[model samples]
Target: MSHIHIPDGVMPIWFVLAGWAATAVILYFCMRRVRDVELGRKIPLIGIVSALMILGMTLDIIPIAYHINMSVIAGIVLGPALGFISIFIVDLIISMFGHGGVTVVGLNTLIVGTEAMLGFYFFRVFLGVFGAGRLSPGMSAALAAVLSLIISTCLMIGVVYISQINPERVLHVHKENPLGKIFSLEPEGENKRHKIEDKRIDIETFAKTVFSLGVFGWILEGVITGFVIRYVSRVRPDLVLSEVT
Candidate 1:
C-alpha cells in the first residue's frame, strides 16, 4: 500500500539515479553486516520470508484498497541486514511482475527496507519496555508495526511530493517533441483557465482518493502484523529475539 505505482518515465532522471545510488550504498553495508554470519540455515529462512512478503504485497484488502507488506515480520525473523536483503529480492521480483515500475525498484526497496529496520529495533525496544509476559510481547510487536508503517507511509508520500515538485521537470516533457505536447504543463493560449481548472480538480481528486483514508489502512496492517509476530514469537522466540547481524 505504501509503494510507489508510477510508471518508468514518471520520475525525474536525477531522482531515479539518486535512489539507485543510495540503495547500492545501503546494500553494500547490508552485505558487509551479513558476510560474517553463517548462512547455511538462514538461506532457507530468507527464501521463505521473501516469499511471504511477496504474497502479502500481492494481496489487497478490497474494502480499503490496502495491501500488506509483511516486511516487519521479515525483520523480526531475519534481522535487519538479512531482512533488507530479503526486501530487495521481494521488490525486484514484484517489479518484474509489474507491481511497480522497474526503474522504481531501488526506491521501493529503500522505503520497505526502512520499515524492516525500524520494526526490528522498535520491537526490541518495546519488548524491553513491555516485558515478555504472555500477551505483552504481542502488544509490543503491534506497536512497532503501527509505528513503522506510519513512518514508511510518510516516506512514500514524501517521494511522491518530491517527484511532483515540478511536473514538467518530472515528466521531462519537451516542447519540440510532438508526443510531449500531451503532457505539457501549461495550457494553450486560449481556454487555458478551463484546462488549468480541470487539471487542478483531477489532482485534488487523486490526492483525496489515495491518501485521505491512509490511517485505517496502516492500522489494519499493524493488527495483522502483530498477530503474526505473536504466533511466531510463541513458536520460535529465537527468531524474534535474535540480534541483527
Candidate 2:
C-alpha cells in the first residue's frame, strides 16, 4: 500500500542511482552471509513467499489505492536477509507488470524491505517484551504487524518529503492558459480561489490522507498475519519462532 507508483522520469537521476547502489550493497552482503546449504533450503520458501506477495500487490481497492503487502508475514517466515531478497524479486516482477516503474524498482525494494526487517525484529521483540508465557503467537504477530506498519508509513512519508525539496528542476508558470484567454471576463484571483476551494494538497494533508486511507488495510493485514503465523506455529513449528515456542 505504501509503494511508490510514480513513473521513472519523475524522480531525480541522483535518487535513482542511489537506490540502485544501496540495493546492490545490501544484496551483496546477504549473499555473503548465507551458506550454500541454507541458500538451497531457502530457495523454495522464497519462491512461495514471493508468489504470494506479487499476487497481493496486483489487487488494489480502487477507491483508496490500497492493497495488502504481506511484508510482515514474509518477514516472519523468511527473516530479514531472505525476506529482502524476496521483496526485491517481487518488486522487480511487479515493475515489469507496470505496477511500479522499472527504474524505481530499487527504491521500492528498499522501502518494502525495510518493512520486512522491522516486522521480523519487532515480532521477536514483542514476544520478548510480553514474555513467552503471557502472549500467544497470534497476538505477538498482530502487535508486530501494527508497529511495523506505523514505522514503514513514517519512513515512506519521510522519503516523499525529502524528494520534494530542491528538486532537479522546477517549472515556473508565467503564461496564462488558453482557457483563461477564452474566458476573458473571469474574475481576478479566480484560479487561486478555485485552488483553495479544491484544497490543494500540502505535507499535512498528504500525510493525513495516506494514513487515513491505509489504517483499515493495515489492521486487516495485521489480523490476517496473526492468524497465518498462529497456524504455522501450530503445524510447522520449526519454521517460525521455534526457540521461543
Which structure among the candidates has the greatest lDDT?
A: 1
lDDT of 2 by residue, 57-98 (tens): 777756454788999888888888888889999999988878
Worst 10 residues of 2 by lDDT: 165-174
Position 53, candidate 1: lDDT? 91
Best candidate per TM-score, number?
1
- Report how far off residue 166 is in candidate 2 (Å): 7.5
Candidate 1 residue runs with Cα over 4 Å from true position: 63-65, 175-210
TM-score of each: 0.84, 0.81
Clashing pairs in 1: none
Q: Which stretches of candidate 2 lie over 4 Å from their true place?
A: 61-65, 133-135, 165-201, 242-245
Candidate 2 global TM-score: 0.81
lDDT of 1 by residue, 5-107 (tens): 7788766666777788999999999999988899998899999999999998778777443688889888878989999999999999999888899998989
